[model samples]
Target chain A: MLLALLRRFGQMIFVMFGISVLVFLIFFVTPGADPAARIAGRNASPETLEAVRKSFGFDQPVWVQYLTMMKKLFVTQDLTSFVNRGWKVVPAVLDTIPVTLSLVIGAAILWVVFGMLVGLIAAATRGSWIDKLLMALGLVGCAMPVYWLGEMMNLVSQSRYHDTWLFSWVPPLGYKNLSDDPRGWFLTLVIPWFTLAILYIGLYGRVLRANLIEAMQEDYIRTARAKGLSETRILLRHALRTSLISFVTLFGLDFGALVGGAALLTEVVFGLQGVGKLTYDALQNLDLPVIMTTVIYASFFVVLANALVDVVYILIDPRVRSA
Target chain B: MLEVRDLRISFRTEHGRVQAIDGVSFDVGESEILGVVGESGSGKTISLLAVMGLINDPNARIEGSIKLRGRELVGLEPREMRKLRGREIAMIFQDPMTAMTPVYTIGWQIAEQIMAHEKIGKAAALARAVDLLAEVNIPNPREAIHRFPHQLSGGMRQRAVIAMALSCNPALLIADEPTTALDVTVQAQILDLIRKLRRDHKSAVVFITHDMGVIAEMADRVMVMYSGRIVERGTKAEILLEPRHPYTRALLDSIPPLEGEKPKRLRSIPGSPPSLFDLPKGCSFAPRCPSRFERCAERPALEGGKHAAACFLKVAS
Candidate 1:
C-alpha cells in the first residue's frame, strides 16, 4: 500500500515536470513564440529586438534559459507578464488560486450530492414517468453549455427576477473571499456554482442511475433480498455502495479538470478572477510565463485528481487493492 | 414445513403475457430434501424466487397459495417477508462467484446476514461467521473472513455462500443449482457439505438442479420440471428406477453411461424447450415425446398419488 502511494506521488511529479518542460519547449522553440520578440514592439528594429533578447537572457543556450525561467517561477517567483506591463505573473496566478478552488469545490459538492440524489431516485422509480422526466431533465442539463446557462441564470436572477421573492436574495456578480465574508462568498457564488454543476449533475445522474439500476439485477442483489434486508438497506448498503465506485471515479476525473481551469467559462460568465480567467487573459496576450505556470498547475490538478481517485477506489473496493 | 399450491407467475411484456410458472405445487417436511430438477428456463428457479419473496419485477403477476409453517406467504407484505427471510428461509443461489457482493470482505457479508435477522452486536455476528466458515470446511476460517469474495476460489466462495445461508439455521434451505457452476470434484465437496448441514441443523432443504445424478445422491424425493410444470415426481427410488414420463426417461437416458461398460454415442433429447409466450395446449413434451398419441393434442394433467407423471401413456397404462 505504501509503495503504491509512493509510486502515485512519483507519477504526479513526473507528469507536472513533463508538462512544464513541454510548455517551456513549445514557447521557446515554436516559430514566432520567442519571449523577447513577443515583448518587443511589433515594428521594432532588428537591433532593438536583439537588445531585448539579451536583456531577458533569451540569447543564452535554451537549457540555461529554461533553468532561469524555472528559478524565476519557483524560487524568486518574480516572473512578469509580457503584454500586461509591470504585472508579476506568479503572484497574480497564486492570488486567483483560492477563487478557482472556491468555485470548483462548491460546484463539485453540489454536483455530487444532487447527482447521486437524481441517480437514486431514477433507479428506484425506473421505467416510470418520474424516471423518464428526471432522465430528460438530466439530458437537457448536460446539453446546455455553461456560458449559455450562466447567462440565462444571471438574466433571470440579476435582472428579470431581481425584485421577485425567488431570486431576490441573489448577490451581485463577482468573487468574494470566504475568510473575509463567508455569507457574501456563499451568496455571490451560489448561482455560478449551480450553473457550473448543472452539466455534471445531469451527466453523473445518468451514469450513476444506469450503474445502480444494473446493480439491482446483479446476483448479489438477489442474495441480499434472500438475506431479508430491507429495500432501503439493500439499496443503500449494497447497490449504492458498489455503484459509487464508478461514480467516484467519474467525479475525480471531472473535478481535476474543473479545478484546472475547465471552469473558465463559468468564471468568465460570473466575472470571477480565477485561474481559468487568468489563463484566458494570458492566452489573449500570449503571456509566456503565466501560460507556462498555469499549464503546470492544471496538469498537477488533473494528475492529483487521478491519484485521489485511485485512493478512493482502493477504499471503496477491496478487490481493487490486489489489482 | 412448507407448502405451495397452484403457484402461477406471469409477466406482461411488450410481446405478450408470458406465464413463467404455471400451477406448480410442492411440499417439504422437516429434515427433508426435495430435489427439483430441470434445465434452464424450466421455471424451477423462478418458483423458488417467488417463494423467497425476491421477485421484484413490476410486470410480474403472481397467483397461488404459499404457506410456510402454516403462515400464508402469498401476498405477505414486503416488510413481513423481509423479517421472515434469512431467519426462517434462506437460499443458496447458483454461481457463487456472482452471488456475493464483490466489494466487501466475505466476513462482513456473512456477518451482515446474521445481524440482519437478530439484534446481536457486529463483533458477535462476525465471530459466528468465522465459525460458520469453519463448519463449511473453509481453510483458515479466521483469515478467510477478511478476504474478498474474488480472493477465494469458486469452491471456497460457494462454501462461504453456504456458510452465509446456514448462518441463521433456517428451517427451509433452498440450494438453486448451487453445484452446477463448480468443478466435478468441487461439486461433490459442496454436496457433502450440504448433506452434513441438513443433518446437523435438521433443516428441510430444497435442492434445485438439472443433473439427475446429483438428485440421486442429494434428494429424498425428486421433482422433475419441464416448461413450468412438474412432469414427474416421486421418491428418489421411484423416479430413478420406475420413471413414468417420457421427458424424464429422455433425461435419464441422456446421462453418460458409467465406466466398465463399452463407450457409446451419448443420447440427448432433441428440440429445445418451448417458449413461455407460445406454449402448446398439449403436454409441453408431447411434440418431442417418442410415444406421443392422438389424445396428446389435449394437455394431460399430472395424475397419481405418491408417484405422478403428466403423460397419457403412463396414466393409461
Candidate 2:
C-alpha cells in the first residue's frame, strides 16, 4: 500500500511538471502575441520595451525562460503580475486560496450529503411516488445552468426580497475570513455553496441512484437478505457501500476541479474574490505571470485529488489490495 | 419441522401473470434431508427463497402458508420475517463466489449472521466464526477467517458459506444447489459436510439439486419437480429404484449406467419443459412424457400415501 502511494505521488509530480510546461508553451504559441509589448503597456518608449523584454527574459531560450520564471516564482518568491506593476503574483494567488477552499469545501459537503441522501432515498423507494418526486427534482436541478441559477438566487435574495424575513438574515455578498468571524464567514458563503452545489447534487444523485439500484440486484444482496439483515442495513452496508466506489471517484474529480477555480460562475455572482475570479481577471488582461501561477496551482490540486482517490479506493475495495 | 401447503407464486409482467410455482406443497422433519431434483426453471430455488422471505419483487404475488415448527409464516411482516431468517431458517446458494459480500472478511461475514440474531459481542462472535471455519474443515481457520472471499478457492468459499449458514444453528437449512458449481471431488466433500452438519445440528435440510447422484448420496426423502410442480415424491430408494411418474423414470434413465453392458447411447428425455408463460392446459410434462395418454388431458394433482406420483397411469403398481 505504501509502495502504491509512493508510485502515485511520483506520478503526480510528473503530471504537474507536464501541465506547467504545456501551459507555458501554449501561452507563447498564440499567433503574433508579444509578452514584452503587453508588459511595457500602451505606447511605451522603445527603451522601456527593451527593458521589459530583458527583465522578463523574452529574448532568452524558452527553457531558460521557464527555469528563470520558476526561480523567481519559487526560490526568490518575487514573481509579480506584469499588468499590475506592484502586485505580487504568488501572494495574490495565495490570498485567493482560502476563499476558494472555503467555497469548494462547503459546496462539496453539501452536494455529497444531499446527493447521497437523494440517491439512497430514490433507490430504496423505487417505483413509488417519493422516487418519482426526488428524481424529477434532480432532473430540474441538473437542467438549470449554474450561472442562471446564481443570478436568479441573487435577484431574489439581494434585490426583490431584500427586506423580507426570509432574505433579511442573508449577509451582504463577498467572502468573510473564517478566522475573523466564523458565523459571518458561514452566512456569507452559504448561498454561493448551494448555488455551486445544485448542479453536482443533481448529477451525482442520479448517477449514485442508478449504481445503487444495480448493486441491490447483485447476488450478494440476496445473501444479505438471507442473513436476516434489515432493509436499511442491507442497503447501507451491502449495496451503497459498493455503489460508493464510482461515486467517490466522481467526487474526487469534481472537488478538485471546483477548488482549482471552476466555481467561477458562483464566485462572480456572489462577489467573492476566489481563485476562479482571479483566473478570470488574469485571462481578460492577458497577465501571463498570474495566469501561469493559477494554472500550476490548479493542476497541483487536481493531481493531489487523484492520488487521494487512489488511496481511498484501495481502502474501500479489498480486490485492489493485492493488485 | 417445516410444512408448506398450496404455496403459489406468480409474477405480473406485460405478457400476463407467469406462474412460477403453482400450488407446491411439501414438508420436512427435523434431522431429515429432503432432496428436490429438477432442471432449470423448475422453481426449486424460487420455492426455497420464498420460504426464507427473500423474494421481494414488487410484481410478485405469493399465496398460501409456510409453517415452520407450526408457526404460520405467510403474510408475516418483513420485520417478523427478518427475525425468522438466519435464526430459524438459513440458506446457502450454488455460487459461493458471489454469495458473499466481496468487501468483507470471511470471519466478519460469518460473525455478522451470528451477531444479527444473537446478543453476542464482536470478540465472541469472531471466535465462533473461527470455530465454524474449522468445523467446515478449512485449513488454518484462524488465518482463513481474516481472508476475503476472493482470496479463497471455490471449495473453500463454499465451505465458508456453509459455515455462515450454520452459524446461528438454524432449525432448518436450505441448500440451493450448493454443490452445483463445485468440482466433482469438491462436490462430494461439501455434500459430506452438509450431512455431517445436519446430523450434528439436528436441523431439517431441504437440499435442492439437478444431479440425481447427489440426491441418492445425501437424501433420505426425494421429490421430483417439473414445471413448478412435484411430479413424484417418495423415499430415496423408492424414487431411485422404482420411480412412479414417467418424468421421474425418464430422469432416472437419462443417467449413464455404471455396470453390466454400456449402452450405445445415453437416454435423454425427448422434449424440453414448456415455458412458464404458455404452459399446456393439462399435465405440464405431457409434451415430453413418452407414456402420455388421452387421460392426461386434465392436470394431475399429487395424491396417495407417503410415496406418491401425480400420474393417471398409477405406476406405483
Candidate 3:
C-alpha cells in the first residue's frame, strides 16, 4: 500500500512538472507577451527598461528565466504581477483561494446531496412520470449555462425582487471573508453556490441514474433480492453503493476544476473575487506573473484531485487496492 | 417444502409479450434435491427466479401460485416477502464472481445476509459468518473473512455464496446453475459441498443446471425443461437411463460418452429453442426434435409412462 501511494506521489510530480512546462511554453509562444515595458510603465527610458528586465530575469536564457520564475512563484513566493504593478501575484492568488473554496465547496455539498436524491428517485421510480420529469429537469439544468443562471439570479434578487419577501434576505453581490463575518459570508455565497451547483446537479443526477439502473441489473442485486433485503435496503446498501464509483470519479474532477478557477464565469457574473475572477482580470491585462501563478495552482489542483480520486477509489471499491 | 403450480411468466417487450415461462409446475420435499436441466432460454432459470420472487422487471407478468410451507407466496407484498427471503428461502446464483457484491468482503456479505433476517449484533453475525465459511470448506476462515469477492478464486467465491445462502438456515435453497461458471474439478467439489449441506441441514434444494452429468450426480429427481415447459421428469435414474421425450433423448444423446468408444465427432442437437416472441403452434420441442411426427403438431399433455413425459409417442406406448 505504501509503495502504491509512493508511486502515485511520483506520478503526480511528473504530471505537475509537465503541466508547468507547458504553461511556460504557451506563455512564451504568444507574440509580444514580454513584460519589461509593461513593468517599467507606459513610456520608460532604456536604462529603466533594462533594469526592470534584469530584475525579472527577462534578459536571461529561457531555462534560467523559467527556473527563476518557478523559484519566485513557489520557493520564495514573491512573484509580482506586471499589470497590478508591484502586487505580489502569489499572495493575491492565495487570498482568493478561500473565496473560491467557499463557493465551490458549498455548491459541491448541495449538488451531491440533491443530485443523489434526484438520481435515486429517478432510478426507483423508473418508467414513471416522476422519473421523466426529473430527467427533463436535469437536462434543462445541464443545458442552462452557469453565467446566464448566475446573472438571472442576480437580477431577480438584487434589482427586480429585492423588496419581495423571497429576495429581501438577499445581500449585495460580493464575497465576504468568513473570518470577517461568518453569517455575511454565508449569505453572500448562497446564490452563487446554487447557480454553480445547478449545472453539476443535473449532470451528476443523469450520470448517477444511469449507473444505478445498470447496477440494479447486476447478478449481486439478484442475490440481494433473494436474500430478502427490503427494497430500500437493497437499493441503498447494494445498488447505490456500487453505483457511487462513477459518481465519485465525476465529482473529483469537477470539484477540482471548479476550485482551480474554472468557475470564472459564475465568479464574474456574481462579482466574487475568486481565483477564477483573478485569472480573468489578469488575462485582459495580460498580467504574466499572475497568469503563471494561477496556471500552476490550477494544475496542482487538477493533479491533486486525480490522486484523491485514486484514494477514494480504494475506499469505495476493494478491487482497486491490489492494482 | 415448496410447491409451484401453473407458473407462467411473460414479458412485454417492444415486439410483443414474450412467454418466458409457460405453465411450469414442480414440487420439492424437505431435504430433497430437485435438479432442473435445460438449454439456455429453456425457462429453467426464470422459473427459479420467480420462485425466489426476484423477478422485478416492470415488463414481467407473473401468474399462478407459489406455496412455501403451505403459505401462499404469489402476490405477497414485498415487505412480507422480505421477511421470508434469506430466512425461509435463500438462493445461490450462477457466476458467483458476479453474485456477491464486489465492494464487500465475503464475510461481510455473508454476515449482512444473516443480519438481514435475524436480530443479531454485528459481532455475533460475523462470528456466524466465519463458521458458515469454514463449514463450506474455505481455508483459514479467520483470515478469509476479510478477503473481498474478487480476491477469491471462482470455486472459493461459489463456496462463499453457498455459505451466505445457508446463513439463515433457510428451509428452501434455490441454486440457479451454481456450478456452470466453474471448472470441472471445482464443479465436483461444489457439488459435494452442496450435497453435504443438504444432508446436514435438511434444507430442500432446487438446483438448476443444463448439465445432465451434474443432474445425474446431484439430483434425486430430475426435471428436463424445453423452451418454456417441462418435457420430462422422473427419478434421476429413470430420466437419465430411459428418457422418453424426444427432446430429452436428444439431450442425452448429445452428451459425450465416457465408457463407449469415442465417436469420430461428438453428437450435437440441431437448432436452438424457439423464441418466446413467436413460438410455433405446437410442442415447443417439435421444431428441434429429430423424431417429430404428426402427433407433435399439437402439444401433448404430460401423461402416461412410469413417470411423466410430455411426448405423444410416450403416451401412445
TM-score between candidate 1 and the true structure: 0.95
On DockQ, the stronger of 1 and 3 is 1
Q: Candidate 3: which stretches are off by over 4 Å?
A: A1-8, A29-57
Q: Which stretches of candidate 2 lie over 4 Å from their true place?
A: A37-52, B261-264, B315-317
Candidate 2's docking class is: medium
- Top-down TM-score ranking: 2, 1, 3
Checking candidate 2 for backbone clashes, the offending pairs are: none
Give all TM-scores, in the order shown.
0.95, 0.96, 0.95
The local distance difference test score of each candidate is: 0.92, 0.91, 0.89
Worst 10 residues of 2 chain A by lDDT: A26-35
lDDT of 1 by residue, B161-254 (tens): 9999999989999999999999999999999999999999999999999999999899999999999999899999999999999998999999
Identify the runs in model 1 with alpha carbons over 4 angstroms from their true place: A31-37, A163-169, B315-317
Among all candidates shown, the one with the greatest DockQ: 1
TM-score of chain A of 2: 0.96
Error of 1 at B300 (Å): 1.6
